[model samples]
Target: MQPYGDVDSTLRAIAGRAEGFGRHAIGGLHGALYLVTSLSDDGPGSLREGCRRQEPLWIVFEVSGTIHLSSYLSVSSNKTVDGRGQRVKLTGKGLRLKECENIIICNLEFEGGRGHDVDGIQIKPNSRNIWIDRCSLRDYDDGLIDITRQSTDITVSRCYFAQHDKTMLIGADPTHVGDRCIRVTIHHCFFDGTNQRQPRLRFGKVHLYNNYTRNWKVYAICASVEAQIYSQCNIYEAGDKKKAYEFYTEKAADKEEAKSGIIISEGDMLLNGAQPCLLTEYKESVFHPSEYYSTWTMEPATHSLREVIQLCTGWQSLCRPVDNMVMN
Candidate 1:
């Protein structure tokens, strides 16, 4: 089987065996299974109701359909919205996690979200220990994912983000210095021809590794407002006719001043483009090697980033089960 074929088969098999497979095993998190049986706006068995309940729960969609949300779904702590084994999409509005902890969101699709604060997923204000995995997000009004207001310990992995402007924003406002404590890990994701701000960071320790990026319009990664970013072992492929500016950009309040932003890049492969402006020479100050933000170590990527990301990204057709089980 081909690479994507293998991934599709494995994902389908896992989804078919257990609707809530791997929901409890993420980052050692354990929760009760809550089945979502309706595509309704509210009431029992709806996704909104499942998220409304303040408990440690794994919310699983038993049906394959689109849920056009009337408003942003506010998710509480200790919850996992798992859309495995089903084709579930959230349109019109997105999910919001504020002051929450220990959350897992996986195998979902978010698109065409418009209007005020219309992001794919908005993590706001003190939210921690979040894992957003294997999802597809695009065409949102604002950002695909915005981690702001001191959110920390977040990981976005094996996801696909495409055809969107302002894909990700870490730390809402540049003046909000409270974001210094934010720590995020982005791995094995695919950023495909995103216009700009694949992520514009501010005052956070962000680790971006083993990701694949292609044809970025403006820039790939921007470190601003004293962000400490370590981008390592990633692959970048520029599109024909498009000038791929050195992948990294610095946006400091005072570019002339010393020690504005800290960015460390190692072993990143650039194809059909020139090497990015080395962060070491651009920034006056950088983070110390001894800084301990995450337990995960920064290591060299073993496999081809192109192959790995192609197999793991976007919405797989295998997610739509043959039975189309609807729990009601």
Candidate 2:
């Protein structure tokens, strides 16, 4: 009935089914259905072929297996890679969402990505109106997901991230002041026992809520170079690093301003010696989701939140039983 309804929702879902800044995203809702009949890296029936097409396509898998990409699968605009009723995984290079718009990727697994600058989903250089939901990502050479170079209006919801360093990076680096327009929403995700960058932000507006981040090697969240993060109702289970949030100073490119990020923590559960620095004492300008979006699922953070994320997050099977009588 609604968009981005909590976890296990259709990724970017069925038109009008995304939450947060990417609520307006519609990924090939009216496009022709393109069946991925093969698991090859590239072919007529392969996933890569459908993705590279110019026209809008709703890509679905007729067969299920691992697709080992030799190179990045660059997706075009108005595309929805819907992995429902099947199991699909990417093993080699990952999906590249470079300067595309109105794209949705859901119900896929990503792991074992090698090489430099390789990410599970890389959205950059002004890509907008994107949603990545219900995916399992880990063990990559670079970040699981990265949004940089002024990319904005994206949402990463109901995903499971683990067993990786540098989980997610918001901005490219401290130099690009144009990253100030970046806006993203992360909700109802499980950040289970990952390293830093759950994610690390540079300059952008981030609305993080209802997430479970636990047993992190580095800090759970970081703010650098004038980032604004609004963290709410999140469960942070501390590990060796008790401090869940970290703030560091970095010069903004060539500017002399020693600008760092600011995080506003509200109704959060900081367990297992999570330091109080998370409740940033002196605050500047912060972006609240209510100020922009009117409708979104808001649930209080509780210990039960763990079970919700663990169960509802990641890829799922949405297949229906066949009626044999219909064939007769």
Candidate 3:
């Protein structure tokens, strides 16, 4: 394992240079990083210290080995963690960020710690503008990802998950007033499963599109609330023989009322057993429905011109080295 001082100094130096250049976005109070050596060492300790300093911090694991957490890593708004790829891994029950906004977590591997309530990632209670990309979370007792209670403007893309109790869970806490739910987008992800989940969804607007699933699982997607959750071009290979999609709601209403619980906009999807099958979720629902026994395919591709331009213009510019190139 790399010594914590080496990593911490490098990050601090970057923050310092960014400050000297007057790039507030790259520095200022939001630029500090928190280095957590091991999950067993003291994660909340690092987080508490960062909070005390009142800076935007990044939590990194020094040990490349697996480190499990007793509870979730409670993150504040506008903070991010860069796993530096899979060099370091956090094996935990899960991560829970409550009432936080503008959180970005990328390039890490998560092993869901043991417990019924364990989930790979859980965003809760008015969290908004959260982005999770290019991560792998697996071996959990519950769903890999779960969102609840008025959390809005969240996106999870380009992630890999397998051997999960259930893949995705979206809904409202029901007990909380003034905490209803709204928009969430999930796309370009992979799920490998063969079992069904309980209480799939309760309330919210969700978009499930172009996701690839395997193992002939019990379900691909579902809903059970008041919203428009749609699935477009999703590929599934459910082990079952039924080609028809399943829509389950506690209350069966007329067409319009039925739409309130779990709504499906587009259901016809093709699958070919590939990876990262271009999924998209453009709407919302609690008890949404999904197709089964489908397959999809995916592979890494070189960048296109438009993609390169967008990448350069966005956050890429901030992380690029002084030499004007992204380091591998």
Candidate 4:
């Protein structure tokens, strides 16, 4: 409770504990700190071996380089991959967490992930109680982050997602009704110049709060397949195209009677764009503009989102500073 009272306190707590900040709900993650001393694919000091071990570990990097993973790095449960105090860039296949629990990934950079299933981080089915914080992801072949197959109780905060066509996907497929179990919290992230899907959800409950969005080529936040999204106190600055929010169904057309995908917006500020067109429950597939759902109302943000997000979002300065900070 010491850190949960305010924004500064919360950030300080997250920095002090790294990925261990949210470990209490899953019975607390206690592990050894495994230092990554090599950039090799596999060895004693390599990240591959560190994550491949069966026990819980806090994987910290000592060296700085780009690690091109030959295959997806399967991480076990109760693990924390902390990339602070080093410049660690991951390319190639990236990371995959399947059926794991109580995982933490923070302060890393992922780019140039190509080939099949080249996501920056893919959380597969039945994984729960995961935290991804303060990482930078871009230019992946598939998606920056994919949470699918009923992954739940996940928090993605203070991360930067940029320069990718497909950014984040919550549900695996439109017809995977099991995805209704997904519950994710995305807060204090920066979606900069992303094409679309930041993220596109399906059959899930996603809470997006206090994030910054700029120059989105396609629609910013999307909901499909009966996904319910609660967006609060976010800043959206659209460039020359697209609105801030959109609703669509995979199997149903815009004119169809299917009423899927719901968005509840509160205290959000949209700039350089028109008001978002909300969906209606009428015959022409258009919802009334003033339609309101009385589920919840977010309290006003205590601090300036633009000011606080700039310091918190993205990979904070490594041991040495990197010039990858993009400011709009």
Candidate 5:
């Protein structure tokens, strides 16, 4: 089986269909193609130059290797960095998505990043309509992916997270009341032995479904400061640590007192004597993802979920022929 689908459906995987909150992300489907022929940090025909371009582009790789970034590569609006064919590993610094929209990132590998606060993908400051799918994220200085500073309408699906501290953060901090606008969907992901924060959310409405989280060091998921999370049909297995879900109390910019967030769970399988710590009393309401959109696929969190996650999540080698040529 491939990451997106089975091997037979690999031909149809190029359709930029993002489920859940980011369903409107077109992601350069109507834009021109820009082939990445070089593996340099920044130059002509390089990935960095194509990302820096102002116009909409569907960037694909022609070669297979590591791209050591010197700094965070600033990506523009309406872009799709599709690494379906090539085995592209990004190290050093990572990609920064700041104040941009309609982006899709697929099938890339994010490994050892050495610098401070260097995430695999940093989406911040009002960026929206993003879909990060089928990517492999591992060690970094900070997080694998962070959606903060009011960035909203994102969907992260079928991705693999491993060997990292603070794997993902949905809302930035308690300092930003603007984070109240954040809405994200995380589905069909495999969090394999990651340290913490499968996502630590603050003031965001997050939907987590059909994922397998195993062997985490600190905690599997967190909600802080007015966040609302709906976890459905996910399998959470523990190693040594036991808190599958954790909450932190923090005073936000607009709060009266310190408050940990709320979580509403449905059909979640917590194994190996895991604890769901301090379940919140969401007396008002919680955001249900099905109320907004319902095209997403899911199954029950059975023992078969472990096998499915191990086989289907992460980068897959599914290459198809391309024709258009629009260079930078």
Candidate 6:
């Protein structure tokens, strides 16, 4: 059979087999499967079937144009979505996985959704061992990447986020909560919240490293009572001078509740002259220490403040400071 013919046949076979409940295995030679297009008229059975597989599977989408999904893409464990060339524009919720394990999403673009709480990607429940790599997301109301509840062992790398209300949001699932402590690794991502939406975050043992952010007066990074946050190598620049005050420290709790918990470490963070990035108590922990009650200059190594403001304000109105006071 011809190459296209074989691909078509394999996809059809997988789809037909996956529709049923019992375990089904389809085998093809190493080079037999190639160049599957999700935007084809048949509705992306090649990719979807790979997602439904119970065993290890590698599915590649050559995004010639855009692939729109009516609902969310629920990918289970042992599955991979690789956008070879195509830009997968998820007009709806994009990708949502609940209670799944060991799934991977890579090399895709997620457009904003119309729904109230639309997110680029959402991992929930006991879902663990997930990786989101080299993805671009924009214009979502809630956040670009969201990991919640007991979801653990997630690694997000080399992703670009901008033109959204909120770039990244992490939290514990309020329902069916667990104490396992979601451990996530975020590295080398770009966050720009130019639209001024609030950034929301509450996660356990999260590592935020080497990220560049802009204009996010609401929050460059936020941690809730449920989070043991660790951060380094991040750069955040404030948009408005007054809004910088909101971007600085733990807000919305009693003095004792806010202090003595979160561990925020060294980073090249930029702030407007009006807002200081340190609290009175945590001044000793700053990587580049600043004097108390003194105005400091922000370095240009950070991203543009306007873009970050849009991302923090336009994406999702979730993580805002409860009080307007800056401790320092």
Clashing pairs in 4: 280-286, 280-287
Please give the TM-score that candidate 2 achieves against the real structure.
Answer: 0.93
Evaluation by TM-score, superior candidate among 5 and 6: 5
lDDT against the true structure, per candidate, is 0.72, 0.86, 0.50, 0.74, 0.86, 0.51
My TM-score estimates for the predictions, one after another, are: 0.81, 0.93, 0.66, 0.82, 0.93, 0.66
Task: State the lDDT at 135 in candidate 6.
Answer: 74
TM-score of 6: 0.66
Cα deviation of 227, candidate 3, in Å = 3.9
Runs of candidate 6 exceeding 4 Å displacement: 1-35, 40-46, 173-180, 194-199, 241-263, 271-276, 279-328
RMSD of each: 6.0, 3.8, 10.4, 7.7, 2.6, 14.7
- lDDT at 9, model 3: 36
Candidate 3: misplaced stretches above 4 Å? 1-29, 43-54, 60-62, 173-180, 197-199, 241-244, 251-260, 265-268, 271-328
| lDDT score, candidate 1 | 0.72
Candidate 3, position 305, lDDT:
21
Please provide, for model 1 over 1-328, each residue's C-alpha lDDT reduced to its tens digit, 9 standing for 90 to 100: 1112232343222221111111222321345567799999799899999888886676778788999998999998878777877888999999999888767787899999989778999999998878787899999999999999998878777789998989999977655778888888787789988877767788787777778878887777777767777777777777752333323334434345433456677777777763464556754355532354323334454445588678868665545333222333
Off by over 4 Å in 1: 1-29, 240-259, 281-303, 317-328
Error of 6 at 246 (Å): 6.4
Over 1-328, each residue of candidate 6 has an lDDT whose tens digit, in order, gives 0011222233323211211111121222111233455563234454555555565555665544565656666776666565534555555567887787655565677886657666788777677767675677887767677777677767665567778766666664333235236666665566665443223444355655555656664555655544444455455556652332222233233234432225454554654542443544653432221221122222233445334423422122112112222222
How far in Å is the alpha carbon of 223 misplaced in model 5?
0.7
Error of 5 at 141 (Å): 0.4
Tell me the tens digit of each residue's lDDT in model 5 across 187-278: 99999999899889999999998999999999999989998999988899999999898889999987689988888877899999778645
Give the clash count for each candidate: 0, 2, 38, 2, 0, 28
Worst 10 residues of 1 by lDDT: 16-25
